[model samples]
Target chain A: MKPEQKPDQQTLSSTFALRINGADLVILVLTIMLLFWVYNRLWFKQSSGKADYLVVQIDTQAPVQYPLNQKRLLELEGRKGKSIIEISQGKARFIHSACRNQFCVFHGWLSTPGDTTACLPNRISIAVKSHSVKDTEHFDALAGER
Target chain B: MQLHFTTRHDDHRIALLAALAISIHIIESAFPSPLPGIKPGLANVITLFCFIRYGWQTALQVSLLRVLISSLLLGSFLSPTFLLSLSGALLSLASLYIVQWPFRQHLKYQPTAIGYALIASISHICGQFLVAWYFFIPHPGLFKLLPVFITFAVLLGLLSGIITQLLINTDTAKI
Candidate 1:
């Protein structure tokens, strides 16, 4: 009889395994370097901006309020030219205006950074400016007195 | 006659391997991450196994099939997200293919698997950043959150690697 042939299964599996192992090693090293680069770019280096205060400007031709009150719904109603800025309840917003788009109305209220409302039709704008240190301290003193 | 028979056998082996890789991909996609874009990438473990057990061609097939099938199933086909997945998979596979040589001679399967998994994870993130820059964010500076991405990658990669190592250890023992 011809010499008995040992099954080649082990040889095949081992050969395949060795080839795969080699590929994996190369992938691992390259990935580590890439991750290091991403970490430095995305995480370690970030920007920080300071806080600001709020300002509101309204056109004289626009509607004016004798006295701004939270209790009133503060509707501009049918008045053609008017703008109103109201600050109460620890937040600020343009309560009502005669602008057609009403984007200023949609701005809602602002208590934080970069908040602004503008009625382009009436040439009125309300902006939240970065609060100075003195303003913050004064606000804090007012809170303490209360 | 013997050569033809061996070629047929190799073809069968490759088909079986591809099927196995797709199954793992399905399972990985079915589970959602708590974070919007995170995944354990359990499928990569199988791709790694195939890359180690068969060859680069098989690994490439597995990676492509996994991305295609997973994207289709997840309803992300034809979307930017699908493109991101494809880029990530290709980068990962390329990295794995390149690192296989040193791993075979000097490292145990566990360490090698861990190292490769980490590399794949990083490559995947880089691919994501490229896509985000092109399609979503215009400025590269917007991706300054690289630390957050890297931390997440390390944690997820370590977990995937550990699981893969355990499976490899068990499979080797059976053999």
Candidate 2:
């Protein structure tokens, strides 16, 4: 056989020999198994109860509470003039605000016990606070946890 | 007869492969994912095949072409989704190239498809995660999906590797 044909021979041999090796297969399997376990622990498992209230706080003033069962539109004052919050179907959202960035308005809704939306520029924030201390601490007080 | 693999042939082959990859990408995207940020990434099979048969440049061209053309077809070009896809492709390509460095140097070490695929998949997810955190969400809360994304990557990477290996073993493969 000519030397020019050696490259083709090598390629053929390489292709014929290609298979999933044991070590790599085992690693992949183990990694995937471990990751699935972690994912289930973090997200898939369920907890009970809904949020008790939507707590809206502006600046240093007292926090305002709205029961989750009630659906209403709140027009509140913020550092950047008027801000609008809407609560419906057990969810609260910062729908509109005068802040330039509109970060809070884009945050969508706070439905879960620990969900939160804050407008830093407007010095306004909303938190879904559960009445039970255990539930509250599990999500809300774990500020540095994430 | 002298077989001249000219630039025109290369260009035509690249275009054909890109079309194949783009079709696969779009079809996969149409399937509803079980979880957010999880994808089978079957298109990377074409990239791996190109890298092994042609070279890094061809592989890069195929990948970028797939991303660009597919995103345009999906109506997500220049959007955050497009940015995420671009970043993921770049990082995976970088990882594939890194794994092949030793072979390029005439070293005895050679990474198999499984190894390359695993590394590329993990890097792809990491790249997308970082981009999502830094630009789209800008919050640590995004980390909540890390484990899910990573698990999917490993599973999908291994799957793609097996598929590529099977294809390479076939007699009909152009390579």
Candidate 3:
């Protein structure tokens, strides 16, 4: 780097050096705002005053509703075998399953409305719901019917 | 008749960078993701490095070669995973190229490694999501995870950008 050289020309090092400048700080602020927005959206469901139950379905059977606030150890029968789900407080989780992988069991607890998990091999699935059955069509639309 | 092959200095540099990125990619794949389609993408530091210290063309070569070779090594070639990797790489590179256009005339104010990396990672994840939605799972339900993905992209992209900056500022980064 020659000190006496004219500053008119563009150099690679001068142009794209990753310094802590105003532009970087501005971007950082924008990213943080986006993160907060996403956090708020996800958090909205929990306190919507309607998130109270979970929907459990074995294979193509009609979905069954269970209150998330009620503590219960529920056993469900599927094609392969039986699975157990534990619901307590405002959260529910798969404690036991017939599948070898146990991905659903490892999925921990689901407490958010619209959250879902499935034991593909056992043909059992669970989804957290926030609305009444009459609004299930809207719910399914929101859930993408997955 | 004997065939002779020539390896230029640029070729050697590209190979070295691609190998570094591929190693990082392979190591990253070994980690279990809490959700599908989420990765730390530490390898992108190399891509960012190439883009800045070397040039756009060299960066492109390193990034693509890392994708191809890593897919082949991971045995996910031509699979959905590979497709996601390809789209992500292409989109990120394109974003960097486009983002770099205006500064071509000037030395200062060009978005540096931090800016470049943030855009690269964000576009990379979006490209992956688009591919996943279009080809594998068309469920809009998948989009429910968008916030989570974007959040990770932003956080990880910033971290990667910072790391790249630190890397370049080091004397040994001249390599």
Native A-B interface contacts kept, per candidate: 0.30, 0.23, 0.16
- In the range A1-146, model 2's lDDT, one tens digit per residue, is 75566778776776667555554565567666767776886577543546779988999998888898788999988887888999888788988998888999888877767778888888998998677724413232214333
Q: Residue A112 in model 3: shift from native, Å?
A: 15
- In candidate 1, what are the lDDT values of residues B1-175, reduced to their tens digit? 3554446655666566667767877777778777656777777787776665566787788678777877787789878778778888888888666656544665465245566667777667767766655555443344555566666877788677666655564445321
* Tens digits of per-residue lDDT for model 3, B1-175: 9999999888888888899999999999999998887788999999999998887899999999999999999999987789999999999999888877877776476776787788899889989988877666654356568888998898789889988887776554446
Question: At residue B4, what lDDT does model 2 achieve?
Answer: 78
Badly placed stretches (over 4 Å) of model 2 are A1-18, A21-146, B1-7, B106-108, B172-175
User: What TM-score do all the candidates reach, one by one?
Assistant: 0.53, 0.59, 0.64
DockQ of 1: 0.14
- Model 1: how large is the Cα RMSD against the reference? 14.3
Model 1 regions more than 4 Å off:
A1-41, A44-146, B1-7, B101-111, B172-175
Tens digit per residue, CA lDDT, model 2, B2-22: 997657778988999899899
**Model 3 TM-score (2 dp):** 0.64
DockQ of predicted candidate 2 = 0.14
Pairs that collide, model 2: none
Task: Give the least accurate 10-residue stretch of model 3 chain A, judged by summed lDDT.
Answer: A133-142
